[model samples]
Target: MDIRRWALDSDFKVTLTRPRFTDGLLLVLLIAITILSPRLLPVRSEGDTVLVRAGESVFRIPLEENGPHRVTGPLGEAVIMVRDGEAWLENTPCPLKICEAMGPVRRAGDVILCLPNRIYIRVEGREQTDAVSR
Candidate 1:
């Protein structure tokens, strides 16, 4: 019988498929995983290496050391300061001080980037990981 004919039939029988137990279980499992992933999954920690990027050049420095490193890019000079296992963008020629305002980042993937200057500071190879928030 054609579906169109069945639709027009006065005594046409129609039924809806009911969800199985496995389907409900799978849905609950997916929701649990999503809720717990953040607390269970690990985040990268602060590293001993600080990478200063200037245009096509990349300079790697030890984050454990205390000092200011200078990098030059399109906008001019920018400084990265490292003190007591923390690093931040000290100064940049960019009109917006957004990069400098990021303050000290001690986590592995944390970055201080100067868009106008094309400079970036990043950390790598640390023993401890970042907190759960990130």
Candidate 2:
């Protein structure tokens, strides 16, 4: 029989062992899980739907008439409008008004985020082809 002995000082010591192939495989698996996790995870999405997030509140607005509407928030306000086959954030009280800068979202996958007011507006349901066309 053989034995190995190690001496320790007053300071705390940690012993680390090198990872083997199986450990590498496990790491790869974990990486894959992290990479593809969002797809596997549950998300709320429907055909041509709108998502509105304001402060601690979140809601969904369904597109119907394609017209103008106001979305109020804690920090400020925003105006959402649809015209001539395009949807857009027309006005915002935030200083930068970056949301308004993201103009004319006519298809799905478009987003208008107002950082100051903590508001997020997204357009959903247009086809991939249509998105590319614009």
Candidate 3:
């Protein structure tokens, strides 16, 4: 039997095998893990703090403190201001300065990143169901 003749034969048929019981069980296990992973992980306690990172330095500032806190990065100074339970980037030495336009962050997990200056700012608190609702 020549390989080409067999491949081109008129009686040739191609079919997909049905999934076995073990395969179905594996799929169900995967779905369960995906649904439960987030709940299984420990949730951090809610806090009124903001975590700021610039280059090698890190600062934890309370959201209740209303002031412009400055941190230096590779480029220059980056000012993060906290007022009325919200934190935002007031100024950045980065070229684009897009981080400043991100608006205020009051809810937990909100982040303002300035990649050009290597700055990262995050608001810390209890996890919210979603960003839009929070």
Candidate 4:
């Protein structure tokens, strides 16, 4: 019943707080969500011919064989050549040659992005025949 006695009790000590188990569980759940969200979401495939946009610049690359080609704009223009079942950047106006470093990409999920020129080359999968298309 005495306020002073209650305040001085060992149970009322401020520094004696124990870590709650729920806090650890919540932290683990947050990490799991972060790791799984991207994998769970549907991603656009590169098999279908699509325009890849990096910033304002857009490049249209085909998904078929000899389909993927590089495009150059007014500042500098170059086209990628695909021959003998290989792809390579034939030319570029940029001085750093960073796009050339990307080399050849054959897979359906590859991308070549030039940040300076705002150009993106994406390899997408071909669309399958479905009732909607028909």
Q: Can you list the residue pairs that collide in candidate 4?
A: 46-123, 46-124, 46-125, 47-124, 47-125, 47-126, 48-124, 48-125, 48-126
Q: Write the per-residue lDDT of candidate 1 for residues 1-134, one digit (tens) a residue.
A: 77666766858676547989998999999999999987775656557888888898988888788998888899888888889999888668899898888898787777777888898887776434453352
| Predictions in order: lDDT | 0.80, 0.68, 0.83, 0.60
Question: What would the per-residue lDDT of candidate 3 be over residues 18-60, giving only the tens digit for each residue?
Answer: 9899999999999999999988875544458999889998879
Q: Rank all candidate structures by their lDDT, best first, as comma-separated numbers.
A: 3, 1, 2, 4
Clashing pairs in 3: none
Runs in model 3 lying further than 4 Å from the true structure: 1-47, 129-134
Which regions in candidate 1 have their CA more than 4 angstroms from the true location? 1-42, 126-134
TM-score of 3: 0.60
Task: Kindly report which residue stretches of model 2 are placed more than 4 angstroms away from their true locations once superposed.
Answer: 1-47, 126-134
Pitting candidate 1 against candidate 3, the one with the higher lDDT is: 3
With candidate 2 superimposed using the best TM-score fit, by how many Å does residue 130's alpha carbon deviate from the native? 17
Clashes of 3: 0
RMSD of 4: 15.2
Pairwise lDDT winner, candidates 1 and 4: 1
Model 3 scores a C-alpha lDDT of 0.83
Winner by TM-score between candidate 3 and candidate 2: 3
Q: Provide the RMSD of all predictions against the true structure, rounded to 1 decimal.
A: 12.0, 13.3, 13.7, 15.2
For model 1, give the 10-residue run with minimal summed lDDT: 125-134
Residue range 6-105, candidate 2, lDDT tens digits: 3254254546578789999999999999999877754433336667677777776666547787777777667778665466676678888777877866
Per-residue lDDT, model 2, residue 133, is 33
Question: Per-residue lDDT tens digits of candidate 4, residues 24-82?
Answer: 89999999999998766654333545456645666564544464465655456666656
